[model samples]
Target: MMKILIIEDEPSVRVGLSFTLESKGHKITTAENGLDGIRIFEREGFDIVISDLRLPGADGIEVLKSIKNISPDTGVIIMTAFADVKNAVEAMREGAYDYISKPFEPDELLIVIDRFIKHKGLELENIRLKEEIRERERFQHIIGTSPAMQRIFETIEVIAKTDSSVIIYGESGTGKELVANALHNLSPRKDKPFIKINCAAIPETLLESELFGHEKGAFTGAVQRRKGKFEAASGGTIFLDEIGDMPLALQAKLLRVLESHTFERLGGNESLTIDVRVIYATRKNLKDEVKANRFREDLFYRLNVLPITLPPLRDRKEDIPLLVNHFLKMFGEKLEKSDLAVTPGTMDMFMEYDYPGNVRELKHSVEMAATLCKGTKIERWCLPAEIRGDGETPDAVISVFDDLPLTERVKTFEREAIRRVLEETHGKKKEAAKKLGISRETLWRKLKEHGFPVSPSDLEE
Candidate 1:
């Protein structure tokens, strides 16, 4: 129910309107004058405001302007015995929902109020939906539900509580930055800023100054004192991506900062202290870099204190269908359509190909399919050419020649097909059995007859 405020100088009219609105289940409050009405409006938020055109002291127009300035969304309806054309037009121009002449029927007032309430409901719902969309977009950076991801989640839970430096180890496109964000969101410092720097993206010559900041005339281009990532992320987290690409000489300075939580700006001897959490991520193996004396051993140990590794997509094939469904729902909502489901055949095709770019590549493929799929169901044809190629299909199971021992060859092929299906489906026995057009019991019997390995782990290379 909406809360409504009624402003009228006449005591009888004010009581009558309040009683009528209250009978309709709206919460009602009354003010004798426009000034009192504005005071009540400010102290308590109201969904709709009903006020007379004339009132003692501050008039209704002044009250309407004040209420609107405070909360523009509060619907205002103007009522006046003097039905001047100029007054009606000006009230509407001033953002009143509608103007009603005095001696208006109760039914007419009810109808107008009902319509305005309906419109307000729709507007609120739209705002809520937009907020939900924005929240989902923000969380889209982190996407995974595999065993490897579960472990990462556990690690994030533990590490987020502390302000310790972290080093994330993963291949390119493994969402290292997403992990960094998750850390920030889960930490007590969530309200603070999160600063990110890509060591490889910036030139080595400028990187030191970029990180440690610079004082005026520190270098040729240094015109004024500058704050760097550490200072910017003070009391927050700074994610240094591709830290393995940092120059060897700078590694010493970085190690000192990590050890002491202090650094000197370029050409400035004043030591600046920062209370920032440093999270580093790199595609290159730091252990190998340290062995080659390219990365500092002490720095490696310091950053690697709380390491999190993201597994590639190939190793977590079981998560593809889940990820595909998630992306389809996400894109469908973004495009203002009902959710689309991928066909089993399309899922089979996705399972067969090796995603070279891991989860990032899979997301791109799903987005492409969702865009191309005109129908509610996404088919194999909607998939990218690389994923839809003929080479990935199970044509080997199809007998081209009918000449050689038909029944025996067919049985052998069927068994092999079932095994291959099982492998592709990640040893979900029931799903594999269904895919092979056999009962679960029959698949189990066949597995026993063939002496197939009992453990699902045996299928992995």
Candidate 2:
């Protein structure tokens, strides 16, 4: 049921409309004047308002404006006499949903109310779906559990509540953008726009217009006026990725905006003020670039206000198992291979390898393995050559495992020995157990403990 408010100077008309709407299962509130209607609308949160165009103390247009100012989504229908149709048209222009003449039939009002309800329902549903997508993207795409990542996450939680300018420092593919996104999503301005610009992606000649907007005929191809990322992100955040690569000339301009919160579009003399938080990410060392005279020192300090450095994946090898499992479940459902599993040998190889491209490389490696593997289990052969550790001797493997704890060392050695025996026997589990001098049930227990499949399909030799 809906809440309907009727505001009419004529008591008979107001009561008649109220009775008609109430009969349709809608709760009705009738007011004798515009002031009383506005008060009732504000206090009771009416879904639809019907008001006479001409009123006593205040007019219907005034009440309409007041209601919209408080709740823009509230549907308003102006009730005007035949001679006041011009005022009704003016009300519609000022955002009145619809207008009905004073002598209108009850069915006409009901039809408009039904249409508004359907439209509102669809709009609310779209908002919910968008929020769900954003929630999944924010939490699922970012994978990390190391101490370094935990510190970064803690910093994000603390600083996201503030409107501070932040600088995220990390190597390429280290998920700097993911950190920036988390900060935006957790901030007060999450409902507003989040504009992202790759400083290195666009040419230097066009970078300024992309950041500060451009007027018509601003340049050779500026045929129409356009608002840039800063203007679009007026109430939210603007993420500047690869900030170190931005031209030195543009860096000075960006610094000016950061300090004053104002900028003029290209070929426009009028300055425009904007309210936006800035987040910068870079793979290069800005201090070194400043010393080398490639980056402006002032701009570097301005962007480095709240610094967060993300650790490389090789430094957080402990997270590989969790990340592997996450991607396996993700891609398994994505690719329609729901029962896929990686052998313990493959996981050991992954744990030992160094990832220069960081988490991005690991995700891609898993995706590729899942896509290309024909069997239910992912084997060492399904992995990339560098990740397989094929040429590494036992001593070399020991060196890689040296930094891990004693328990991890034992697990790594056991996984490697079982893998080698399984390979020698062409994935015959019983024969491989005999070769490893362990019983079949014991081998199965070890495989289970190491996240390997104990069946023939899990071997994938």
Residues 355-434, candidate 1, lDDT per residue (tens digit)? 88877878877876675555588877556656877564544324432454877566555655665576478768877877
Q: Model 2 misses residue 263 by how many Å?
A: 0.4
lDDT scores in order: 0.82, 0.85
Over 1-461, each residue of candidate 2 has an lDDT whose tens digit, in order, gives 89888889897887888888889999998888888888888788889898888899689999999999989999999988878878988999989999988688989989989989999999999999898556434433676667777677779889998999999999878889988998999899999999999999999999999999999999999999999999999999999999999998999888888888889999998889979999999999999999999999999888888999999888999879878988888888987888989889889988988899888888877986786555589866556556876686656655665888998778777776776676568668878878888877788888777655556554443
Best by TM-score: 2
> How well does candidate 1 score on lDDT at residue 16?
88
The C-alpha RMSD in Å for every predicted model, in order, reads: 14.6, 17.6
Clashing pairs in 2: none
Candidate 2 stretches with Cα past 4 Å from truth are 1-140, 390-461
Show model 1 residue runs off by greater than 4 Å.
1-141, 390-461
- lDDT at position 104, candidate 1: 81
Best by lDDT: 2
TM-score of each: 0.55, 0.56
